[model samples]
Target chain A: MSQDSQPRKNSRFHLTVFALIAMLTAVLSVGTPAPAQAEDGTFKLGLVTFLSGGAAGPFGVPARNAAELVIEAINKGTLPAPYNSIGIAGQAIEPIIIDEAGGGTKQVGEYRNLIQRKNVDAVIGYISSGDCMAIAPVVEELETLTVFFDCGTPRIFEDNKYKYLFRTGPTSTMDNVAAARYVLDINPDLKSVSGINQNYSFGKDSWADFKGSIQTLKPSVEFKTEQFPKIYAGQYGAEVSSLMLEKAEVIHSSFWGGDMEGLVLQGAARGLFDDFTGVFTCGETGMFRLADQIAEGTILGARGPFGVYAPKSPLNDWLRKNFMARYGTPPTYPAYKMAQALMGLKAAADKAAATAGKKPTQDEIIAAFTGLEFEGPGGTVKMALGNGHQAVQDMYYGQYSNKNGKPTMTNVKRYPADCVNPPDGVTSTEWIKNGLKQASCK
Target chain B: MLKTDNTSRNLCIAFVLLLLVGLILPNWLAFLTTIALAKAMVVVGLVMLMRAGLVSFGQGLYYCLGGYTVGIAGQHLGITDAVGILFVSAFIAGCLAALLGLLLCRYREIFFAMLTLAFSMILYGVLVKTSELGSTDGFNVAKVTLLGWQPSPGQLSLVVYSLACLVAFLTAFFMHRYYQSGMGFAGEAVRENEIRVEYLGVSPQRVVFIKYVLAAMLAAVGGSITAMIAGHVDPEMAYWTTSGEFVFVALLGGTGHVVAAFIGAFLFEVIRTIAFDLAPYTWQMILGTTLLLVIFFLPKGLWSLLKAKKVGGNNV
Candidate 1:
C-alpha cells in the first residue's frame, strides 16, 4: 500500500503541470482584462435563468425578481455601489431577459445566442442546477463574462477549465453539508436516516453530499432508504410509500420547485412527518411559494448568503429593504442571490471604470472580476482565485416555524465559508478561450 | 393519403432550411432552434404511437433511461464518443423496453399506457436509489462521440442533433413504410376491431407486442440523441411528465403525418419559449390557445397549415 501510494504521489505530475500553467497564466494576465474591448458603450445584458415551468413558479420567480430589481436599479441609477456605475464605455446598459426552459440543450442554445448574437455585455442568473451545468460548457466556450447566482453545484468548482464562469451561491455540496450539520446538530440522538431527492443531478448531488457529511460528522448513522422520484412527476405517492416503509429516524429530502411542494403536501397528508424527524433541506426557499404546505417542524436549509434578519450584515440588511421596497414582498434567497451576483459583476464594472485610462475595456473588467472581492448586501464575498474558480460564500440553516401564519426557518445556524471546501484540482475561472474556434453558428 | 408518410423525404426540406439557419443566424438562435429540433424528434415518435391507438405517459422513463444509459456508459465504461454513447444508450433502453413491452403489450388502451408508466417509474426508482450513477445528482457528459465523431461546440451538438432528427425521420420513415404496407393495415384493422384480427388467425397480441417494442426503440433513439446533445442526463427524463410530453406533442400535431410530430414538437418548444418569455406566469395560455386553435381550425394538425400555400395565379 505504501509503495502504491509513493507511485501515485509522483503520478500527480500531470495535475501539477496543469496547476503551474494555470498559476503562470493567472500571473501573466495580472493587468490585462480578458477581452480588452470597450463594453462600456451602449450594450446588451443577457439574463438567463428559469422563469417558467414547474420550478419557475416557485424558486425561479424569485430569481427573476432579483434580476428585474437589479436591472431597474441599475438603469434608474438607484442600485447602490459597488454597482452604481456598472456600465460600459459611455453607454447605458440594456437588460435583455431570456428564460431557460427544460433541461435539454435549449438553455445552452439561448445562452449562445445571448452572447454571440445579442452581444450582451455580461450574463447573470441561473436558478436551476441542470440549466446551470448545461450552460457551463457554452459560457466557457464563448468566453463571456458570466456570473451564476443561484445554480450551485460542486462540479462547477471542481473543474478548472471554465475561467469565465463564476457562481456566488453555495455549491450542491455546501447545501448538503450545511443541512446535514443542521439536522445532526438538532437531532444528535438520531442514528438512522434516509434520503429522498428529485431524480436528477441536483437531488443526487445533494443526497450524496448529505450522506457523506452525515457519515463524516457522525459515524454511527445507519442509512435506510434512498428514494428518488422523477422530476416534475406530479405524484409522489409511491416514493412516499417506500419512505414510510423505511421508518428511519430522520427523513432527508432534497426535492424542490413544484416537485418539492407536491411531495411536501403529499407527505404531510400521509403523515410521513408525523413520527419522523424530517430534514426538509430545500423547504425554506419555496416556503412562500408553497405558503402553508410545509410543516412546522421540518428543517429548511438555505442556499442563502445569510438571511435578512438573521445575523446582520449591513449590506444584506440594506439590500433586503431595497428588495422588499422594489418588489413589494420580502425577496426570497434566490432573489438576493441574483441581486448579489449582478452587484458583484458590477464590481468588475467598477474596476473597469476605475482604470479605463479614461475608459476600461472588457478585458480590464474581466481582469477586475478575477480575485476581486466586493462588499455587498451579503457581506464581503470573494471570488475564488483558486483553480476551481468559485468564490468564498456561506450557507444558512433554519428550522421551520410558524411565522405570521407561514412556514419559515428559525433557530438558524451560520457556518464559515471554508467549512465546505471544494475538491482539489480546481482554480479560478474557466472560459472558452477559443470562442471563434467552435463556430457557435454551426 | 399515406403519401404524407414520407417524413424522412420531406425532412430534406427542413434540413436545407436548417443549414441556412446554421450559416446565417446568430449562434444563440441557431443553438436554441437546434434544441427545439432535437426535441421534435421524440415528439414525432410519440405522436406515431398515439395515432396508432396508444398514449404513453411513460415516454420520460424511456427518455431518462436512454439518457442515463449514455451517461452511465460514458462515465463508468469510459466511452466518450457521441455515436458510441447513443448506440449504448439506445441498445440498453431498447432491450429493456423490449422486455418491458412483452409484459406491457398484453394490456390494451389505458392499461397499456398505465403499465408502461409503472415500468418507467420502476426505472426512475432504480436511478434514484443507486448512488453509483449519481442518483438525482446529474453527471456531466463530456463531448459526445458520434460514430467516432465528437461534437465539441454547442453548434456541433446542434449539427449532431440535426442529423439525429434525420435519423428519427428515417425511423419514422420506416414506421410509415410499415404503416403503408400490409402489416400497418393489419394493425389498423386490429385497432378498428381486435376481435376480427384475432378471428383472422393472426394473433393481435404478438403484432401489437412487436409494434410496441419497435416504437419503444425509436423513442429510445430520440432520447439517446438528446442526452448526447445535452451533455448531462437525469432520471427526470423518464418521469411521467416527460412521457406525457410525447403524447402532448403527438396530439398537438394530430398524427396527420409523421412530419407533424416534428412540427408539433417544434411548435410546442417554440410556443413554450414564447409563452415563458412573454408571460412566464401564463405561458401555458399559449399552449392552451394553440391546442384550442389547432383542434378548432387545423384539425388535421400543423402540417396542413404549412402545406396550405396561397395559390395566386399558380405562382404569382
Candidate 2:
C-alpha cells in the first residue's frame, strides 16, 4: 500500500469511530432530561396511546385526539361549566405524548421514563388491556398519579390494589352484562344464543360474562355454538359459516377495530346477520364508518354509555362540536373515554387543592380522586368499585337501522351503573355465578 | 497473535468500565442499560450461530422458556432467590434446546429457521391459552431476594442492574475464550463446507447441536435477566416479532466479536428510545431508516467501525 493511501485509510477509520461515539452520546443525552423540580409551574402530562399500530386508526388515534382537544380546551378555559378551568390546579397543561405500539415490557420502560425523567405530574392514556394490566403495578411502585383512559379489562383493579392508579373508564363487565340484559329486554322469550369473539382476555372474559349472565337470567335458554377466532384475525369465513349453520336466535360478539369491520362485511355478505339477532358488545365505533355495511336490526354498544348512546348535556355538546370542527369527524366512544379521564383528573386536582388551600401533592390527589363522582361528556362516572380506583357507569345498547341512507340507533336501552356492574366486594365472575342477585334496576 | 491479545485486554477493560458505569447511572438510564445488556446476551449467542452459518428464527423459544421458568419457579416452588431462579431458567431452557436441537440440527437454512419459529409459536399459543398465568396479560414476577437478602423497593433496581453487569461480564468472558477454542473454529469450518469438516474428522451435526444448546442457554439467561428487571412476563416475549428483534440486534452488531453484541444492543435501545420520544407517530419509520443506512454503509455492522484493518488483511 502507498504511504498516502495508508494515511487516508487511517484517517477514515478514526473519523468513523468519532462519528459512532458522537451518535451514541447524542442518543444518551436525549434520554437524560432536566432534573425534576416542581418550580417549572407547568404541569407535564404524559399521554400514551396507540399512535402507530393496528389499533391506532379506530381506537388509539381517537383517544389521542380527544386528549389533545380536551387539554387544549381546558388550557384555554373554554370548556363547559365545572371544567372551564385553566389547566389542573391553575397550571398550564404541557403534554408529552407517547406511542403505545410496543408491548408491556417496552411500556414499563417508557412509564419509568415519564416519571423519573420527564417528571410528568400525571399520566392518562392506554387502550390495550395488556398494557393497562402491566402498567398498573409500575404506577403504584413509582407512586405517580395515573388515569387509565380506555382499557376495559376488569382484572387490573380486581387482581390487585393500587394507590396511584385509577381507570376512568368502566370495565368490560358492564358491556357484556348490559348486552345480556338488552337481549332479554328485546326478546323476553329468547330461545338460543351463540357468540364469536377474539380469543384474548377481553374477548374471552366478555364471552364468559355474557354467557353466564344470560344463563342466569333465563335458565331455559340454550347455547348453540361459540366460535373464538384469534384476535386480529380479520377473516371470519369459517366462523360465519358455522354460526349460520347453527341457526341460533342470537349471535353475540365482542369484536372491535378492523376485526369487527371485517366481520360486518364478511358476515353481511354471507347473510349471517339476517339469520340471527346480532349483539355486538363493542360495536359503536364502527357505526359511522360502516354505516351502510352494518346489517339492520343489529344490536350495538359503545362499551358504556358513550358515543351514540351518550346523554345530551352541555359538556357533550361542546365536545361534539369542537371535536368535529377540529378533526372533521365526530368523536367516538374511545374519544369520550379519554375526555372523561382528563376531566376526572382535573376534578381530582381541583378538589385536592380546594381541601388543602394550596397545590395538592400526589397523595392528596389520590385521596381526593378515590370514590370521586365526576361529570363527563358521557354523563356521570362514579369511582365506586375496586375500592374507588375503578369507575362504574351506566351501559347502553341500541339496534342499528339504515333509515334513508343514514345509520341511526333505534330501540335504545340503558342499564344503570348498579344494575350491570358487579358490587365492589364481588368479582365479575363471582357476581355472574351468583346470578347477579345484587342487581337493582328501576 | 498480537491482535488476539489486544482484543482480550480490551474486553476486560470494557467489562470493568461497564460495571463502574452501572454504579453511577441514574434510575431510568440504568434500567435502559440493564435491559440492553441483558438482551446483548442473546445477541452474543446468536453471533456464534451466525459464525456457524445457521440462523434460528425461533430463539424466542428459549427466551420465553427462560422468562416463564423464572415466573413458574417463583409461583409454584416459592423460589425467590435470584441465583436459584436463573439457574433453573438456564437448566430448563438448555434441556428443551437439547431435545429440540437433535431434530433442528438435521435441517439447514430456511428450514432450520422455520422449525425453530414453529416451536416458539407453539409455546406462545400454549402460554396465551393458559389463563392461570394471566394469559395474554401475563403475571408479574415477585421481587427476588439475593441469597436471602431482600432489597427494599428503592434499592431493588440498582441491585438488579449490578447483577446484570456481573452476569453480562461472565457471559462475554466465557464466549471470548470459547471463540479461541478448536471447536469454535470447527463451527466456522462447518459453515464453510460441511463435507470438508467431515473429512477433517469432526461431525458438523455435533458441533451444530452443541452450539445450538449453548446458544439457547445464553438466550434464556438473557430472557431471565429481562424478566427480573421488568418484573413481568407475557406471551409476547415468545412472539415471532421478538425473535426478529433478536436477529435485528445480531445483525446491527455483526458476528465479528462478542463485545459487538453489547455495543450493538446498546445503540439499538438508545436509538429506539430517542426516536420514539422525538417522533411518537412514526418512530418505526425512523428505526427502519437507521437499519437501511447501516446495511448500506456499514454492511458488517457498527462494530466494523471500531475494528482497525491490518496492513495486509481484514481485521477479524
Candidate 3:
C-alpha cells in the first residue's frame, strides 16, 4: 500500500509543478514591456484599421496605407505646404498598427490594450461607425486623445459628448445631402427617386438624410421605392429585382467596400443601371475595382471632396504622386480622409506645443483641436459642428465616366461646407426635417 | 459520499487559487482572463447541449440577449449594480429560453441547428433596424458598481476579474455535479437511444427542454459578465459567426469535464492573441491549422490528454 501511494504522490507533485511552470511562463510572456521609445522622443500613435475581413479592400487598407505614407512623409519632411514639417511639433512619429477587423466589443478591448499595454500617446483610426461609437465613450472615460478618421455616422457626437474625441471628416449627412443637391442641380425635372442602402445606422441615416434633403430641395420629387439590405450581404439579386420592378428615374445607394463591389457587379450583370440613373454615395471608393463594370453615366459621390473631386494644389499633387508610386494605385476617398485626419493631428499638436512651450498633454491637444481649421488633401476641413468637436467639409458629386482605362468622376459639382452641413446647435435629423432652410448654398 | 466530499474540496481549492491569480495578474492579463472565463461559461453551456447530441448554431441569441439586457439596464434603467444586472439579465434569458425551449425540444440534429441560427439572425435583424438602440453600432455599457462600492476604472477591471473567476468556478462546480446527476446521464442515454430511454419511462423531450433552459441561463450569465467587462455590446454578439466560435471552443475542450471548457477557452484566447500579434493578416489561417492539428491528434479533444494519462496509471 505504501509503495502504490508513493507513485501516485509523485505524479501529483509532477502535475502541480507542470501547472506552476505553465502559469509562470504565461505571466512572464504577457508582462514583457512595450519596446522602448525611439531617440528624440517619438510621438507614439496607435493606428487601428481593418487588416482583414470584408472592409479591408476599400476602407481599411487605404486608411492604413495613408497612415504609413503620411507618417513617413512627416518624419522625412517630404510633404508640401502647411504639412511640411519634421514631425508633429518636431517630434518623430512612431505608429503601432492594430487590426480593427474584430467586432465593436473586441475593438473596445483592443482600444484599452493599445492605451494600457502598448502605451500609445494618441490613437487615430476607426472606419466602422459602430467602432467609432463604441470607442468614443471609452476614450472620454480614459481621457485619451483620439481622432476618428472616416466613420461618417452623425450620432457619435450627437448622441453623447466627448472632450477628448474629434472627428476630422464630414458626417454621413454631408455625403447624402451633397448627393441630393447634385441630383437637383443636374436633373431639374426629376420625377421619381428610389434608394437602396445597407440595413444599418450608416445606411439608414444616409437614406433618411438624403430623402429629407431632396424633399427640402425639390418637393415635387415623388418617392418610388427603397430597400435596406443587410451590410456585407454579397448578393443583391432580390434587391436588384425589386429595384427593377420600381423602374424609378433615379436610384440612390450608399453601399461600400466588398458589398459595393458585389452590388455593382451583380446589378450590372442584370442591367439595373441601364433602366435608371443610379447615384452611389460611396462609389468613388470602389471605382478602381469596378471601373470596367460601372455604367458610363452612373452618378458617384466620395463621402466628401475626395478622389477625383479633391481640389488641386501642390500639397494634393505631392500626396497623390507619392501615394500612387508606393501603392501602385491612386489614393481613394478613404486614403484622403486618413491624410486629412493625420494632417489635422499634426497641426493641432504643433499649435499645442507652441502654446505650452513644450510637448503638450492630451488636454492641450484637445483645446487646440477645437474650432481648428487646416488644409486637407481635398479642401479645408473645419471643426464647425458638435461644439467644434466634429468636422464639416466641402463635398462633391458627379457622374462616373471611363477616362481611358480608369473610371473618374465627370461633370463634378462641388458643394461648399455651409451648403451641406447643419448649422451649430441643430441635430442632423432636426436640420434635415426643417427643410435645410437655413443652409446657405453658393 | 467520500468521493463527493473530495470533489467539493478540490473545487474550493481551485477557486481559491484562481482568486489569488486574479488579484496578482496584470490588468491586461486579468482583462484577458476575465474575457476567457466569460466565454468559457458559454462554451461550457454549449457542452451541456452537446452531451445531449444537440448542437446549437445560435447560442449567440441568448448571449446577445444577456449582453443587451445588461447594456439597456445600465444605460436606461440606471441599474449599475453588477450582481443586480447579472441576475436580471440571466432571469430574462431564462424566461425567453423557457418559451423557446418548448418548441425547440421537438427537433433534433441539423433542423434544430438551423432553427437556432434563424432565431439569432432574427435578433440581429431587429437590432440593426432599431435606431434608438444605436442600430448596428449598439451602445456603450456604463461602469458597474459592486454591491454599494464603486471602483475606479482600474479597480473596476480587477473587481470584475475577481468576480468572473469566482462565478466561473461556481458554475463549473455546479455543472460538474449536473453532468454526474441522473438527468445528466438521461441526456446521454436519450442521445444514444431515444427509444430505450422512452421504454425506461424517461421523457427525453422533457429532459432536453430542461437542459435547453439551463444552457440558455448559463450562456446569459456569461454574456452579462462579458458585456460588463468589455463595457460595450453590439449586434455582432448575436451574429452566427460568434455562435460558431462558442461551438469551436466546446469541441476543442470536449464534453468530458466542465473544467475542460475553461482550459480550452484560455488556450484559445492565448493562441489567438499570439497569432494576431505575430501575423495580423493570416492569423485565421494559423488558428485553423492549430485546430486541424489538435483534432487530428486528439479526436476527443485536448481534455483527453489528461484522461489518457490517468488511464495509463499516472493518475493525479
Best by the DockQ measure: 2
lDDT scores in order: 0.66, 0.88, 0.86
| Candidate number with greatest TM-score | 2
Q: Tens digit of lDDT per residue, candidate 3, span A4-114? A: 555654565467459647855764665565567433488889898889988888889988898899999999988887777688888888888888877887777778777
Q: Write the per-residue lDDT of candidate 2 for residues A334-399, one digit (tens) a residue.
A: 999999999999999999989999888889999999999999999999999989999999988999
Query: Candidate 1 or 2, higher lDDT?
Result: 2
lDDT of 3 by residue, B28-130 (tens): 6787888899999989888888999999998999999989988999899989999888888889989999999999999999998999899889999899889
Mind giving the per-residue lDDT tens digits that candidate 1 earns over B111-230?
A: 988887888888887876676665554566656665666555755756664666567546656666776677677766767888988788878777776667666666776776676666
List the candidate numbers ranked by lDDT, top first: 2, 3, 1
Per-model DockQ against the true two-chain complex: 0.15, 0.59, 0.40
Task: Supply candidate 3's per-residue lDDT for A203.
Answer: 89
Candidate 2 chain A TM-score vs. reference chain A: 0.96
Regions of candidate 3 where Cα sits further than 4 Å from its true position: A1-27, A34-40, A269-271, A403-408, B1-4, B148-150, B309-316
lDDT of 1 at A410: 72
Better of 1 and 2 by DockQ: 2
Q: What is the interface RMSD of each candidate, in Å?
A: 20.6, 2.2, 4.5
Per-residue lDDT tens digits for candidate 2, residues B122-199, read 999998888888888888878788999999877888888888888898888778888988998988998999999999
True contacts kept of 3: 0.47
State which docking tier applies to candidate 1.
incorrect
